[model samples]
Target: MVKRFGRTSFTLSIAFAAVLSAAGAAVALPQLSNGWPYAPTPQHTDRTYTLAAVGDIACEPDTTENAGNPAQLKCGSASLGGMPAEFATARQADAMHPDLVALLGDEQYEVGKLNDFEQSFEQAWGGLKMMERPSPGNHEYYAYTKHGDNEAAQNGAGYFGYFNGHDQNGTPYPQGQAGNDTSDEQGWYSYDIGNWHVISLNAECRSAAFGNDCSTTGNGVLARETQWLAQDLHADHAACTVAYWHQPTFSATTSTADAPDPAAPGAGSPEGTAAQAWWKLLYNAHASLVLNGHEHVYARFRPMDPNGHFDPKNGIPQITVGTGGEDLDTVATSGGSYTNPNLVTAQDQAFGVMNLQLKPNGYTWDYRPVQAGPGFGSTALSYHDSGSGTCRG
Candidate 1:
């Protein structure tokens, strides 16, 4: 059901007595039927609609004080990146009234802790007055991977807690119930929007092991998401599929040179991690788009197969808009799997977001940097790169 709530328009300052009176502070979050993730149901708002997708924000406060240990960088907080700044970026995205804002992944950096999310949601991206469908990043699995802890065993309990608690009114999501099994894996979920069928798969997995072996599992290229993709794709031929995750299977940035090992944790090369698996499933099914971050830069590519081969016959176009004002990385000049001749556009040194116009034909992406605002000192003209195949409205 569609609903609306009210909040203080003006930032309020609590009086002395108000501080102590705040003892019983409580908020009601959304109540999910099975207590997983959800949205406010897509309301018909005319046929013309706009949607936005971004992730790998790794938003953190200005100071590094709250950062987790350096070892957990894969899943820990990036205290270096300011959360408030990125919040402003999201605010701009809100101005467009995107029909549905798909959170690509790595929404919070480091350990995907609730505290970091609190700072981010309340300060940044809070301008959006609706629901957000988020995908899980490798950072979301930090606690579990780093220490093999049970706290996150239940689908990132702490991360869920942060989202549930941060919700202002009874948002109806958590419904006060907490998760208990990482095995539950609600983070890798899916939903529909407009003429699109979207999926958020976890990127940390190679074949995405259910337990210890890949034989009985389907995490990465495994049968789990693969099977899901088949059903969802077969369910609707016209419905475009858009998939997102924390890291891109293909990143030409210097930072991702040490891509994780798919065969063995810490042993796999960056050459073919989850991208290989993703390519097989998405390319064959002809998914319209794929999104990624972790590169700290903005880039979009022409439709291509898993081996970085340009295959217009059936390929998934990808966008790396990890440039949500987090620290930027330099572009790499490496060749082979990391270098694809089919690159439509690439600006490794810039920080910006890429927007796609999902029309009836092949799509077109416009890369707009966040700095174009105030400090940009008056800049105009957005960047555009037309990919292969027909992606027009």
Candidate 2:
């Protein structure tokens, strides 16, 4: 209700599913309570909430995989893209009165190498680097082609070394603190933010690549991540719930047969058979929304149950947020636009990040696309919706 026209921040107790997640130093979040550094609070009383999703923050890849090797690296294999833009996005989010960030995936380009931890992601998102409630994407898996063909390095390493993805509270995943029974680095995790509890899944399923998993050990990380997703979702009834990953479970963009070089659809394009089960899991749980990338363009799916169940009573909204610094992929449609009943809105022109204002009613999703030429930064795309809890009972 607050009609402030500038940046701001607020102080509120952020939380989760029947448990207390770790809390920050009680530092006042910018833009959520007070006016932005540029704007002063007006002597008026009003009610409001603001959250922004700064589209995609990543490097522009030359090939499909985009991850460059040490031999001939491009995009610096940076963790995230557009440092200044990311900073702006964070500031914009902070200023917009955000309770927490949604953290859409593909955090790092190329491989999930150790170097990117500092260079790519940390450098780009800045303070955002502190709280990473991440879902593992194909790229996050650091997946690599065993064949090692010409552009092999671009796919990144499917190494699956060791990772401990935390929730917004900064605690280890699966509800236990460092116990061997359920303790190990993993791709999927969950956390609670504000009145909502969220799960970050590792949808970058690459079990088929290795005899077991890409790792020298036959530990199937993809399966582990999937199991965790189910448990995470069932653990609570937060006012609202959502999940973030790297690949769109459903995107209108198709893999065009006639495109440039390796970027072609036949070989590798992102969406695979990995997420079918997870898709169903989401439908049953009725997650409020799902965020993903890897298609190079932005697309939003209509609210429907998984497998086209089309349960108007409770369907999740799926969105594709792939337009960061990466080049747009050839426009193709998995189905129709928003009018088609089966599919929602679809377009090739949209290229930017998403800005969201998370509220009790729902989070407002704004697609801000970048313009042609240079220095334009980002433009406001006229499309967004509220997905507070289509699945809430």
TM-score of each: 0.68, 0.62
Task: Name the 10 consecutive residues with the lowest summed lDDT in model 2.
Answer: 28-37
RMSD of each: 12.7, 11.3
lDDT of 2 by residue, 1-393 (tens): 122232222211222223111111112111111001122222211233344443345443344343433322345333223444344444544454543455555555445443453454555454543233344445554444432423223122221221233455533343221111121334344544445555655454452332234221123555444444454555556666676766655544544342222221112423433564566666666667777776666676667565544556677777776665433553463343232244455444444556654455356676655432122223434434333332262
lDDT of 1 by residue, 1-393 (tens): 121222111111111111100112222222112233333354332243355666666454433544343432322234233554476467656665565566665677555666666666445665452545566555655444443323233234445565444355423243221211234334455554545555666554432323322221223223343344344444444446677776776655533335432112111323235346555666666688888776666767667776666767676677777766555565555543434445556664434555555544345555666553222332422444443334211
Off by over 4 Å in 1: 1-46, 62-81, 143-155, 164-182, 206-223, 254-272, 334-338, 360-362, 372-393
Candidate 2 has a TM-score of 0.62
Residue 76, model 1: lDDT of: 24
Residue 345 accuracy (lDDT) in model 1: 64
